[model samples]
Target: MNKNLRQTDQPLRQILTKPEVSSRMTKWAVELAEHDIGYRSRTAIKAQALADFLVEGASLAMTGQDSPPSGERSGEPWILFVDGASSKEGSGAGLLLISPTGEELTYALRFDFPASNTEAGLADSPPDGYNRGQSQERSQLVVLQVRGEYEAKEDVMKKYLAKVREVIALFDIFEIERVSISQNKRADALSKLASSSFAHLSKEVLVEVVKQKSIDQVQVLAIDSSATWMTSLMNFLNSGVLPGDKTEAYRLQFRAAKYAYAGGTLYRRSYLSPWLKCMTPEEGDYVLREVHEGLCAAHVGSRVLAKKCLLLGYYWPSVFQDAAALVQKCRACQVHAPLCHQPARKMVPIHSPWPFAQWGIDLLDPFPRAPGRYEYLEVAIDYFTKWMEAEPLATISGRQFRISSGET
Candidate 1:
């Protein structure tokens, strides 16, 4: 019995030592051995079997899966999952491609603009071909699975969808399916990760994303010879010659003395102040909006708005006027302004010829009951002298008025 068992163990050891099987199974066995010492050998055997199954699947994809005849059915399908997310910070798209052999490749993109889901989908289409390269030509079937409705409703979305369809038309076979968000969690997570503040990607990964330029900066940098104001300033500064009237020429000369151009930017200089950034009309508007109503702005009044722009070292000919106009048009200020309490009309005084010539009398009623059952009082005053007389009464009537007036 012992000899028979040894013979069987020898055959098993020889089978495990075979080069073709050992090369593939060695790494799997070594990894499984780290955690489960008691069952390491068994686990290694199981892992090796699983790896063989995967290899078989891949081999089948390469050999048996041939493209169908022209105008007939297509080859095995490649699976694609897509998702998009938008946040206050930015927008992002995620795509996962599963090859015929079940190998998965993930891709993520971050957008500077607040992109809609449809836009993200449109943005994702071109990258698929770029990543697949020549393989896309051989791929006969391509199925795209998204987490929401595939229909394009908005005009912008329709344009994006049309582009996506154009991209899809390049492939011989294409299909689109709408799946639940939960089913597409991996792609969804990738999108959220791209949109998140903490997703710090390497420069190589972010090379394709375009950085956003500030409206003020873009308008300022867009200044060229075609811009009349900028051209006049540039010519005046460069040659000391003015193009218009003498008064305008003198004004330009004076301004040219105060202003200078460096690296394509116009700057104003003064002995007492720091260099002020001179801006065009559009740039001025952007500065006013950012200064008066940006994230840290307090919605200051017109004069203060202009002062704020000046303090921030920005200058334009119509800075004050533009600030005033922007403040006047501000809906927040209009909706939240405080009520006014000042009198609208002027007051005139009444004069009396004598002390008692013009007397004003009034009756006070419903006072707390005092001594002698008095509940009402009649008061009289002389307008000129500002003198007063008062008498209390238990009852108020015509007879009481006559007694109070000393007419009885």
Candidate 2:
């Protein structure tokens, strides 16, 4: 009870149980690390317990006893044990709610079994000669089989009578005689009802949904153990898995230490515990020289080999950019290179005026000739200084091709 509410203020817990108030609370430990003294930073411990229940009012100290119903609150209902293993079969759960300080009550995530007989009522049953009903109409015929034929049993009995009138309008029966119950035990009861049915407004929202499902199951087992540790460090760094005589790079780091001890035993019951034994053998020869020098300069994928194994160090660095863009788009140098086209555009330079300018002529042809001399070769050109002139035409009639276009 927070040490019986700090020993009921025995002179402010003997001046905060002093040694000069623990050396002035260790020289004002970072301005009294205020989680109302329990210590945590980002504020809101339920807005400091509703600012100590609006500056100590609701008849003050309930748990201490301004009014505690003195008995029957019993125990149970602070459950939260989740388990989700996967090498195929693994799922455990058990959850109870109401601890989120019920201001409007809400809790979900349920594999909804016989949840306290669907919250009492006994999950419906009782027809064939209605065993003379009475117990509140057999608990309204188990709330019409706990509204099962898929809801609408008079709209789930008018939404469970409007959640019993919004939980008696935010508590009143003396704050339900200042309710108090606490229990936690797992490893059974389906992981304590899957970690107590899920009611969270704090405990950092159930420890950020169990640290985001343990970072989505350690990012899917660190992407299948980084593709079996980059295919056992590229087949022991390119073909050398203890075949020939002399050993090398310690037989490729003893076959990348048996694929990094079977990918660190599939992330050893992971939450990345013991941080995958910090991978070693000089971090698998610096991730096999950054995936063979990034697949020989420019083609590494698995998100560039998980960003070159986290810039050559790795702390579970997982890129897997859609499995490195499906391995550099199934390379064959990106599926056979050859798809270039862009050539067409030129004209406008008819400037002459003199000095063999503007001239233009062309007629070149002669091959395997001299036997009967019919292959002609006469050329003359000068389109504004691209000058040239030659002749070897013995027959290209039509007046020798109009005197070879007036000899340039």
Candidate 3:
């Protein structure tokens, strides 16, 4: 018999392996020897099979059979899940962007200003989703109007719709779909977290504060292709061309004298220092961000930061303005700025109707250790009479306190 069959032959197995057997058992053992059977302890086949099955299932779960292959193509679609959350404290949203390669990008947005009907849509639009996403009926998502099923009657919505269309036009392929909130829990949690506080947020999540409405802003054109403030100065140095207007041409001439152009770079003349490199407002803004938020930055005040940049030998017409704007937009500077210690309510002045009518009372201090060992001092001052009285006590008692104040 095979080794597999020998183990299951229980009737023969019982006595086959035993050395000291009775005649009857030995007879049976000898009879079983013809089949080449042997005996060993039985294993729990059912239980072991079950355990192995469970281990295989767990491994399959970890490997994620439903997940798409990592071999990515250039045109693979990106999946973005967004949810908007707002509270009386503030408005914010959460966004989860999943790349085709399975990389997840998480973001929490805090709206700096209070959200209005139109603004609320923008507030939530940062993270809101639909199909598997949104508040469905009452949702103000920008894509909601673009879906064409819903109409945006408000001017702001129209403007937003136009802006959304403009942005979508930039992409070669773009699609919007709805998703239920349950399917987008990560985005929903992020939105709520942003509405509360960012201090307790997870390290993997990025937090951003939106200070202005997107509709109010214009698109930024390329500086090189468009007219810049440096255009006039550049014209005078390169080709000696001036504006037709005498007044403007004269001003341009004066400004051009202070600047020198060579090797395709602009430089400004300085009395005690070497020629300082001149930059456009856009370039200056970048430098300001580096100096104020870079490794060496202490996040100093805007004015101080601008002065430091000047000392570093660079100049721009809107240098100060750019520095101030950058500082104002800095998340760290705004969050950690000096707090006002003043009371929230306005202070009211106490008025006295007449002298000695009523007195203002206060504890002058913890009772001084005087010769009498007074440990508490209760002072009373007449608001109108300007008279004062004080009582010192080594130990305080309700009865003593009333008597000392002449309340009895």
Candidate 4:
């Protein structure tokens, strides 16, 4: 009856010859069409329905869902995620809040400091005046983006767990029934007014935060594509045993290349892909190209690659031989030679039975004893006891005469 159905008449004729096959196909088409219509609508409704059914089916499922009574519970814990930026001109900090109801609240500060997340394009100049949406905002922007981008990555599960731990620390603050986060101090202040601490609330009454469902998977595809795996592999190689071969080296090179292609250049002159900026490489071609070029540049049948391989390090910058040689021959390093410290002085304590244990002896010569007499004085003291003896001599070298006088 339908034009689309008419096109399938040849297959249907064959099926018609076998009444059983025709019956099955007709039933299958009806069921498939019905399923298609139902499936589209069910995507949203079905998940909620399933959740409700599961919650109803088991009382234990609702255990983690309990919210304390508002009167008994402290005001909701407020979280402020701050993003900051810094430049030669100044610095800025930005904040964001996630409410219990999945609302996003944002705030920004422009000022100066040694705040977190200062690195950006690595250029010497700031682009323009401060604006809320400007990327030129600097450190705050970079850190926030980094945090968000990092959270979007697959390897951020441990970090995400850490954030959860941080949020849990609020239990020390108040009887937290609900948790909210703000980018603005105003929201934080408001929440603080509601409940400054959650310590008064029972552990059972404190509601476990319902994390944003999309956060776990946020910008995931972009994150995976842009992620440079070389550093991770390099870390593994440094901390553990890495298999030796062209394959391993090639893998490392690939990661470097991808990073370079992704604007992770030592010179900071590389192109930035908007797609890559979002979170990941839109196409894997850049990564492949980067890897190939990196391997060629690093390996090129030289000992530089070998020297690099022998080193075990974390986050060591990728330095070619020229850079290594420059660092080695640095004037400051040559002039400031490595320290060679003198041995520590050994403590030698002075000991005596009464006072001084020993005394020193000396001679004073060429002294005028009288108007016409040239003379010397023989002086002695007990080394430890400090007892002194002195004798006036008519001439130098009168040791024999002094001894005869019983100076001892």
Against the unseen true structure, what C-alpha lDDT does each candidate score? 0.68, 0.40, 0.73, 0.39
Residue 59's lDDT within candidate 1 is: 91
Maximum-lDDT candidate: 3
Model 4 quality (TM-score): 0.18
Clashing pairs in 1: none
TM-score of each: 0.37, 0.22, 0.37, 0.18
What is the Cα-based lDDT of residue 18 in candidate 4? 48
List candidate 3 stretches off by more than 4 Å: 1-75, 116-144, 219-408
**Higher-TM-score candidate among 1 and 4?**
1
lDDT of 4 by residue, 32-58 (tens): 443322111112357888898887867
Query: Candidate 1: lDDT of 306?
Result: 95
What are the candidates' C-alpha RMSDs? 23.9, 21.3, 25.6, 28.7
**Residue range with the least summed lDDT across 10 consecutive positions in model 2:** 174-183
Cα lDDT of model 1 by residue, 1-408, tens digit: 122213232333444444356687666555543442221222235888889999999998977668553223434566778777778878877767776556787777777776766566555663333222211211111122221344445765555556566676676656565566676887777777787753576443332352442221243456454464667887667666576698888777776877888877888886888888888889899989998889998998999999889889998888889988998899998888787788798778898987688878899888999999999989998899889999899998998988888841
| Model 2 Cα shift for residue 121 (angstroms) | 8.6
lDDT of 2 by residue, 1-408 (tens): 241122231344344435376666654554433424432234335777887878777446554575432122532222222222111222223232333233222222333332232332221211122111111221233334333433434554445444533433442221111111222222123333333544532342222122222111333334334444444455554564453445655665764653343432322123332323334334544454446445564444455555555454443323443335445555653666456575566656687776675666666665557755757777676766767787666787888777766663
Model 3 per-residue lDDT tens digits across residues 1-408: 465343452555545567365456777666666675445656657988899999999999987966655533255666777667768878787777776667888878878877643445444442322122212212435456767777878887777677666655655556776677577788778878887776687777888888887777777887657877878898899999999999999999988878999988888888888888888787888889889988898999989988888889898878888888888899999999998899999999888787888887776567449887888887788988889888887777777677778951
